[model samples]
Target: MLAATEKALEAEMNRLKLAVKTLQGEDKSEEIYIGSYLLARLEELGVTSMFGVPGDFNLGFLDLVEDHPTIDWVGNCNELNASYAADGYARVKQGSVGVLLTTFGVGELSAMNGMAGAFSEMVPMVHIAGVPSLRQQATKPMLHHTLGDGRFDAYIKAAEQFTYSQAILTNTVSAGAEIDRVLSDCVIKGRPVYITLPTDLAYAKISSDRLKIPLPRHPSPNNADVESFVIDEIVKQIAEADGDVVVIADACAIRHDAIDELKDLLYKTGYPVYCAPMGKSAIDETYERYGGIYVGSISRPEIKEKVESAKLILSIGSLKSDFNSGNFTYSIPTTRTIELHSHWTNIKYAEFPNIGMKQLLPKLTARLEGGKAKALQLEVPRFDAHVPQETDDIISQAWFWPRMSKFFEPKDVVIAETGTSSFGILDVPLPKDSVFLSQILWGSIGWTVGSTLGAALAAKDCNLNRTILFVGDGSLQLTVQELSTMLRKGLKPIIFVLNNSGYTIERFLHGKERKYNDIVNWKWTGLLEVLGDLDGTLSKSYTVNNKSELTELLENPKFAAAEVLQLVEVMMPKHDAPRALQVQAELSGKTNQYAL
Candidate 1:
């Protein structure tokens, strides 16, 4: 006991000396709490807002977030919605990572689905879970949030399947390094990462010296010889193609931060550019070289013919999920395709690992600039907003999508739910600088409502234009509670809820008249009044049943530019679906093979 007491006293003396050195500015590493250090890193990454729910384990951390100078704690309706919101925020605010806070066990489990969806869609996010203290964990006592079996790692183990990296911060000594590693992985891999912050460690003082340097966003440089060889091979292929090559951009082209590099290739080479369903808005669709969306068999005949006939297809960041590629119907053989990914490249049958598009695109563009790949003047199908001629006043899917496209202005952020909206809006061309957000690969229904909240907040921070969301009534029921949180935060977004009678997409896929595909019909316009808009001062709701009413509403400047939140209930036939969806559903049905 005497020796232990003496050792404790010596440790105290050492701490005091370090504190004095810090105060005197002699020590370069300033001391800061672990939570503060983490928040500082997030702020450096331009995280203006974080989404989460308040729980006992995370309340102390929330105090730090509440007191933060720039980071706002966006209290959400639930953990799942918060996770979805974070995904949307990251999608809108490029070059920044989305931050999510949740309590251990139940809270983190609730957010698991959203995190998995973000991982599937390649959205960069950091999910910080506040767990029990070190002392508590050491005692192995039965905790409220944990199972009675004392299996504390169960949740994190479950999260391992979804996240790119995981960090369990046990001590202040390693807290900064752990945080940096997880955050760097989150951004570099463009996927969600899990970090467990114990309550005790949240305030533990750690040296902040590492915070002086920013985290590395890009991966390490490729081998000089290998990179040069790869670039030369790509240039040779393009030059030999004699302008028979085409460029197809997909979802990862945007998520991996290769848009600028991709645009350079498209412009300099003058190659006809097409995007997959998931890659909408990755490049400027208004450009003359831009063709329409390519979804394999589901694509329009003209687009399919144009893309399939190319001798060589340069596929950038291609994620050929079933829906994105029309149920794996891509006819382009591996021998005729060159694929560029975030961390590797594949030329025909040969794979060149570690040669990423972000670094290689510039070299390829430079080589192709001076007549290496002769610029061709090929005819691109004009993708303009043209409302179909309909005799009836009732709004149909074909008419609604094109008409809505006309209402979109430059720099608008458009989010679509997975059902009708995602397929419906795919045919329409958005204005330049417009952002398109959708969970195409994941296809999570009702994600748009929570995403709109996050996207709107991000839009506010980035000083972008209006945020518009299109969601089906059936899908909205799952996440409608998030609208209250949006109103509380004073975010103005125009939400168009298609009030069809039932699950239209499911009907098309299977069980066309099944009762399971039906949902409870809510009083569409009374939502705002019940959801904290008692005085009707903060919001407005409208129900448009016909083309004339929607046309007038879309044209009204006050309705379009409302300072308050707006919800438009668009009445449409229950059986109608977008043409793209009809084609996709048939392909998906054949793949499902329920009868077989």
Candidate 2:
């Protein structure tokens, strides 16, 4: 007892000594300002890359960033683009937070869309904005970029709606804690957080001991009682079911670390698991018990028939959204439906039954006697015959995905940019254990590029190899500033830019007659070369207009050594991709049916 007490006392003394050292040596107030301190905190948080477009208000901060070897400042053409890239980097790197710096008002507002998207998708990001100095705050006179009267509170309130949390740093003491709290929340909740730093505060000198970097607290699920009950109910239903049972895995199910557990459940039961479009590739495609897309127009007929015939529908982490349930076509009738989700279980609303997945999964596993069920046979439909000859002229998302699949190794992590490219990459067969991270719920473009950096960082920590990125031309241009980050860090990733010009997905939805579909054709190859810090060893660009050129570039030895390689100008027409074609066919069929 005496020895244990002495050891504990020694550990406490060591911690106190380290704390004192951190206060004395690390927090010394130099002539260097608050911006430097802010940069220091970012560096301490392991944020090596910052993406943004420098403006008059934030230029000082940018200069400070330039001098900091630990932090690399990247420039984008627009603030929104920078945010998107940062979002992508965060998703890829997992624990690494995204830092998006922009000037006040318009710059801050422009990036809000991306931040909101990150919030919805639960991507951890930090949005830092340079606001007008404290002296400029109370002036009733008109100010540039000011929304109603000159008060900044309205804009801050607007930001609050989109992020997990928001704060304005009027003074130094408030700045550190607020920044720490917001960043800590972002890490804990896995969502975007906002901080607005006043221009004047950037140059102010802060006291030494006041610099406190709080460790983040990760809270696990506290309420397990309800979850256990739901799991028991699900297991009872499954055991009683006579017909082949089907488990429809959704995005929420993918969370809560249930994949392996659910896979084990499937292996024992021999029940096929079908994922929704949003939940595509939830399980290994090679898994014999795996069934493909089920609800949308893209679903296989065999999978559809099985779903329709199932006596028991075991839905794990399923949201009964319009996109998932064929617009309510597959509503449960007399069938026993066990709906599992987060928080609550056995939820009944207006006569609909639903249960909590967290409760249901564990209990269900416990109740079941471990044994393999007989394999059930099912037929799958072929949609190739419906595809038209003209579709061949356009690059099929189907063809593109299979080829792209080859680039991903078992350990590689991929971030898919939003729009048609996102849909295209969703079906691609990834190697076992390969992670596909995306802001699917937010559908924010330009997020993948920045998220890729974060993913790459995460991959490095996991001892994983190269991080692969698939981005649309429209999205890539938005966050192209992050190229400097890749070069600065010496992180290599294969970037495939699907360059068909402006918002192709939106264009397809609006129809070809829309003049807004056009965008300024950026020379992506030239841009990467210029933006990259050329030590003559870091970056290279390749332009591939056709399959032959793409093949040649992939085969070249020079491509292997390049730290940042950009495959520019690969045209994929909107009409060719499966999702696009499906939509087109539906619209065309409606028109034809009405004409007849």
Clash totals, every prediction: 0, 17
Off by over 4 Å in 1: 1-29
- Residues forming the 10-long window of minimal summed lDDT in candidate 2: 379-388
Please give the lDDT score for candidate 1: 0.88
Highest TM-score scorer: 1
Q: What TM-score does candidate 1 reach? A: 0.95
**1-596: candidate 2 lDDT, tens digit per residue:** 22222333453454455445545554544444778767776665678778887877788778788989977776665777677767766654544678899888889898888888777766678898888878888664567878767676777888899898887788765555566567767765667888887878887776434344333423233245654555555666666775356777876655433465576666666676777655655666556667666664445556677776776777776655543445444645535676655434442231223333433454465455353443355332221222223333444565566566654567667767766765665444567676777665666667777667656655765677667777877787766777666666667877878877677766655555576776788887777567765554566666676555665666665664334544445777644555533553455345445432
Alpha carbon lDDT of each predicted model = 0.88, 0.64
TM-score of each: 0.95, 0.73
* lDDT per residue (tens digit) for residues 80-199 in model 1: 999999999999999898889999899999999999999999999999999999998888789998889989889989999999999999976567777877887888899999999899
